[model samples]
Every structure is written in C-alpha cells, then in structure tokens.
Target: MILSWRKKRAARRAAKKQNLEVTSNMELTIPSHFRCPISLELMKDPVTLSTGITYDRDSIEKWIEAGNSICPVTNQVLRSFEPVPNHTLRMMIQDWCVEKRSYGIERIPTPRIPISSYEVSEILSGIQTAKDQQDAERCREMVLKIKELAKDSERNKRCISANGTGGVLAAAFKTFSKVPFEQNVALLEEILSALITISPLDGEAKSYLGSDSSLHCMVWFLKNGNLSGRRNSVLALIEIVSSDQQKIDELLEIGGAIEALVKLMKEPISPSTTKASLLLMYHIVSNPPSSANSKVIARLTEMELVKILFEMLVDCEKSICEKALGVLDEVCSYDEGMEKAYGNALTVPVLVKKLLRISDLATQFSVSILWKLCKNDKSEGGDVLVEALQLGAFQKLLLLLQVGSTDGTKEKTTELMKLMNVYRDRAECTDSLDFKNLKRSY
Candidate 1:
C-alpha cells in the first residue's frame, strides 16, 4: 500500500510539472513582429540573408536544405546562401525575454550556426536545373518547391519575386496557354496554384504581365479553369490591372470579362477572393471616364451583380461590407442601378439592418441608397418606404438624429423620414413606443 501511494504521488508531481511548463508557455506573449517570419516563434538565432530579411536560422536552413533558392519573404532569388548573424537583433530579443521573465517568458538560449552556404548553393543549382528543363516531372517538382518556399517568409517572397519566379511562371504560362488542353491542363493547374501561392505580384512583375495576351489568357482561364484556377486568376488579374486606368479598361473590354468577375462575386470562392473581385469591380466602377463607367455599370446590371452585393452584406467583414456599400452607393446613383436595387427583395432590409451600428461609412452608404429609393415619389418609393417602416428604419433614423450622424447621412436620413411621413397613407407606418421615445429623445 505504501509503495502504491508513493507511485501515485510521483505521478501527480510529474503531471503537475508538465502542466506548469504548459502554463508558462501559454502565458508568454511574444510580439508577432519579433517572431521569425518562417517559424513564427521567438528567434534564438536570427540571421539576415542578403535580401535583408531576418529569419530563425534553423527554419531558414531547413528551408534551404529542402531545395529552395529563393528568399521566402520577398520571393526574390537569393544571390548567396550566406546569412549574416543579426547580433543586435538577437541581443534585443534576449533582453526582451529576460525582461519579461516575470511574466512567464523563458529566456531563449543563444543559437549556434548550423550549416555553410556551399551546401545551400548545391541544392539550389539542382532545383534550378530541374526547373530550366521543360521536363514534366521537373516542372511538377518546381511547382511544389516554389509553393513551399513562398509560404516561408515575407522576405523570401520579395526574393522569389525579385529573382524572377513570376517571370519563370509567366513564361511557363505562355508556353502552356498554347498547348493542347488534355496534355497541359494539369500542369497549368499546378502553375496556377503556384501563382496563387505567390500572388499580388510586385510592381515590376505586374508591369511585365499586363500584356493584352496575358489579359486574354486570364479571361480564358476564368471561363474554363477549375475552382482554384478561377479564384487565382481573378486575384492575378487584380494584381495585373492594379491602379492603371488603361489596364482596368482593357480588362473590362475582354469578352465575358465583366460577367466572369461578377460571377466570381457570387460563386462559392473564399471571402478573400470575393473581396478581391469586389475591389476590382470597385476600381472599374468607382472611377473611370463617365463613358466607361456607364458601360461598366450597364454590364454590371445586366449581369445581376447588385443581387450578389446584397447577398454579401448578410455576413462579411466590416471592411468588405463597407467596400460593397461604397460600390452600391456608386451603382445606385444610376437609374438602372436604382431599379435593380429596388427590384431585389433583400436590398432594402439588408441596408436597413446595416444602418444600425455597421460603420460610419456603411451607414452613410445605406442612407444614400435609402435616400435615392425614397426620392422617387412613385409607387416604387412608396413600397420602399413601407418596407423601411416595417423594418424599423423610422426608429433608426430618429436614433441617428440623436447620435448625430454625419451631416450628409443625417440629412439623408431626415429626408427619408419626411418622405416616410409623406407616404404613410400608402403604407401603415409604425408609431411604436421606441419610435415615440426616439422622436422625443431627438
């Protein structure tokens, strides 16, 4: 009995010690910026490569061992494998660890240098040789290699990008874009995945990729490619078109281009992709020569894009919702846009819900949209007014007056309220206690 008791006591002590270790690790608050970009942890031995990115030596060395020539952060090719020891950064990290010891952060031990640059160069050369030859096997290898390398660090991204990975991929895309579909489709999918991995091509790469042929190829891919390909293609176009008004015009000019992008907005793609598509549309619709804007707006309406925007308002980030609202505000300024918005059943209710504490900008856009809808004195306006009353928009307006919305929003909301009064006979306007209290409070 005494021996069993002692065994249990010993087990409990060991478990308690393990639990303490976990608790200490959990309580340590390592600042994200202090972490090694690759490992995302406190750097014991931080080393800066030629590309000027500091990574934990172990993580970066392992990355090099895996046959990657490019820096992970910048996606630029590493000129040399040599990573200079960042002594000052190490000391600062050590000091921080020591200073935070009371807060349960353990001191990071000094890190030792692991491998020489010669080994890294050997691995890189082999990978480059494999990539240079148009060997299908080698191209497949390059795809995964580039994808993993791009995932390591931001500095490595700059390195890969600067070192011409995008150009390499773009060159491959040019070659594969022409080949027979059955033969090259899989390889092209791999290339597209790699491109998606290192997306938002830098300015220099974007400049090279903004060709008419590139734009055409992307549109084709969007039309025919698989789900991943389509999403990546849209993101690639966003980078390619960027802020150049001419490129935006060129993108819209491609056949099925506007429709393809609008379709992407409604598709089951990730939120980020959807937001990117929206941003691209915003660029085209938010500012352009009025002639171009009119054409784009017409295309958007024809594609039923307004309904998609309303669907997005149901659950999206504040920033994304704000951008969508901004686009809605611009689109609804047109007669066709207003008709489309008013025609959608969910439009007014979604806008009304968002007005209740969604951001200041969102509220402004909602008010603008409501104002435009209410400005029409016909039955359409009366219908919207009735919906607003049913949705408690009247209470929201009174609250807005009390909370002091922006001059424009307040003015529009007040105008909407007056219009509601004008149309009260057409629709049974609610005069609930909240409405009465809001009016008195205002």
Candidate 2:
C-alpha cells in the first residue's frame, strides 16, 4: 500500500511537470469546463444551477437534499433548485475523452434525460385511463413505471414528489385499497413503494393522503402486512396526521389503529419502526380532540402503554427515551396510570437513572413522572419512596436542584426531596449539597 501510494504521488508530480490537468488522485487530465465544480471530476451528468455554476448531478443533488439552500460555488441562496442539464458541455467532455483515449481517458456515455414533469403527468394520466377502462394489467404496469421512476434518480424522485405525483398516487391508493388485499396486492404495493420513496408528503399531496380510506389502508398494513409495509405505514402516518386534529380524529375513528400501534409496540419490527410508532402515538395521545383527552388516556392505559413505556425506557437512546418519557408522563396523569407506572419493577429505577442523565426535556418528564408516583403513595415506608431512596434518589434530587432546571421541574424535585428527606437525617440533605451550584440555581 505504501509503495502504491508513493507511485501515485510520483505520477501526479510528473503530470504537473508535463502541464497535464490533474484535479483528482486518479490523474485524469480533463479540461476545466469538463469538470464539475462540486466534485471536481469529469462530468458524466453535468447540471447547471440557477446560480450559473455547473456541478455533477449526484453531488449537487446530495447538497440540495441535505437542506443546503446556497450554491456550492457561488455561495448565493438558491430561490429554487431547478438544475438544468449542461448538454453542450457534456458533449465537449465526451469528444475530449475520445481524443484522449491513448492517455487512458474513457469516453463518457450519453446520460439519460432526467424524467420531466410532463412525462410524470403523462404517466399519471395513463394510470387514470387504465383505471377508467378497468384494465388491471395496464394500471399495474403504469404504477410499476412510477415506482421505477422514483428509484431512477434523485432528480426523478423530486419531480414525482413535487409535481403532483404524490397526490395522484394517493388517490390511486384509496381506490386500490378498496380491492381485497389478496387481489390487488401488486398494484397496492407498487403505489405504496413509490409513495414511501417520496413521502413525508407535502402541500395537496398530504391533504389527499389523509383520507379515511387511506387511514384504513395504512391501519390494515400495520396489522397484517409484512414488516417493511408495517414500517412504512407508521412512517407515512407520521406525516399524514402531523398536528391536524381532524385527521387524528379520523385515524382514531378507525377501530384498529390504536390497537395495531400497541401490538406493533409489543413486538417492534425494527428500531426506526419503533421510534416512528412512538412518535405517532405521542402525537395522537397528546392531541386528542377537545373534551376527549381523558378518554384517550384511558384507552392507552387499557392497552398497557404504561408497561410498554417502562420496558422501552431501560437504556434506550436519548431521543427515544425522551419521547417514551413524555408519553409516560401524560399517561401518569390519570390516577390508575400513575400507580401502574411506579408499580412496574423497572419503572422507578429507570425513572431515577434518566432523571438528570438525558436531555432537559427528558429530565423534565422524568421529574414529573417520579413526583406523580410519590404524591400518590401514602403507605408507610411507601414502596415508591423507599425504592427511590435506596437507588440514591434522595441525593439525585438534591443534585437536580443545584443543576438548574425549568422552574416546574425544580419545584417537583424540591417536593420529591422533601418527601424523601423525611426518611434521611435532617443534616444529611443540606450537608452534602454543593452550595456553589445551588447558588447558581437561583
């Protein structure tokens, strides 16, 4: 490896001495205009940004996809990322490659024209035509074409997502969902695969996707479909419902939605699946229709969500732990829910461990959860109090006070300290306290 590295470095030095163009380690002596600004390589698919800078399609597309709004070369904020292909420059590069074959340069093949919105419109129209003619084979073929288009290039995926393909596919999903799953499995799968590729849908696309029939379709998949399908359903629903109370109510109206969520939580198919499901449930339970939140809590409690949350909290990631804690805090607001929370052997210990350990939000939720538990425990040598004390909950609560928290969390911590301090020496609580950090707490 060392010898190979030395040989390559020597070759690059000789190429510079001979005045051959060398931008990359591979030492391709290409013209300046033939190389992409972002990748600084021979442009196979050169695309010009509105900023008048050309970059390789894959490189610039990745930049835009990562949420960069400024052109890489110009550093100007992009109003829109409608990159046009530099066909003339591409031909020049190809011709130069052919002339330099003896120099070990390969001719670049003509790249396929990116799928346009007009082509996408035609494909959508063909699917509608097939549906109207009751041509199942033609409809499936059209849908499959769309599925393939979504995978062809990032450019194509953007076209399908932004140029009304999502809305068209959503309408088709509703229609195909009516057909028995066994009968329309292929067609439905194709539509869903394409939609998922371009999903977290926006504008009128999500509006159509939030339909009742669509919710039912996703719920069916959540309950009966394969792991991949179930995972997509959860992910799709995350975008569909968002914070829309009406859509959430419609999803809740579907009989099996929450039940399927619980079942999926129990035997989570994948980590992303589990996180998405937790996020969806948090949204649903937290935003129940006005006057119906209590009922929502009761429903979730009956589903054993408290137990599920306790199990999930054992050494989970910070974000997942934060969400689970958020939901558990809400569930514990119900009288029976709080009892079930600390009642679990794992709940109190997990709560204490995460008290000051995770993010500020998780710490807030953990404090709320522990406070609820201790407030409701009136028994002598209360299990909640004793268990918390043995786990060093007494010292942790004191530390939390000095570490600074939201006023509400600090108040709750102070309350918990007072409750636990009764079981400890009066001087012990104040003796070990870090007065400097405590002074900063004020």
Please give each candidate's TM-score: 0.66, 0.76
Model 2, C-alpha of 382: deviation from truth (Å): 3.5
- Please report the TM-score between candidate 2 and the true structure: 0.76
Instruction: Give the alpha-carbon lDDT of every model.
Output: 0.75, 0.79
307 Cα displacement, candidate 2 (Å): 1.5
Off by over 4 Å in 1: 1-43, 46-140, 162-192, 289-292, 315-320, 404-407, 424-442
lDDT for model 2, on a 0 to 1 scale? 0.79
Give the root-mean-square deviation of each candidate in angstroms. Answer: 9.5, 8.1
Q: Write the per-residue lDDT of candidate 1 for residues 1-442, one digit (tens) a residue.
A: 9999999999999998887777766756677767999989888889999999999887898899799999999999999887899999998998998887656777887764442334334434544565466555666676666666666665555456555566667666655555344466677677767776776666655665576766777787788777777777777777776657688878877899888888878775677777777777777787744876887788789888888888777778898898899889889878778889877877777888788567888888889988997786368457888878877788888888998877878888888999887656666655332222221100
lDDT value for candidate 1?
A: 0.75
Task: Report the lDDT tens digits of candidate 2 across residue range 1-442.
Answer: 9999999999998977565434333454568887778788888989899888899888998899899999988899987787899988888888898887756678988888889889989999998887677666788898888878888777788888777877777777777676464677667667777788887676566776677667888888888888888888888888887846678888888888899998888887788888989989888877743467777777888888888888877747887888899888877877767767755777777787786778889989988989998988877767787777766788877878888998999889999988887777522322221113221100
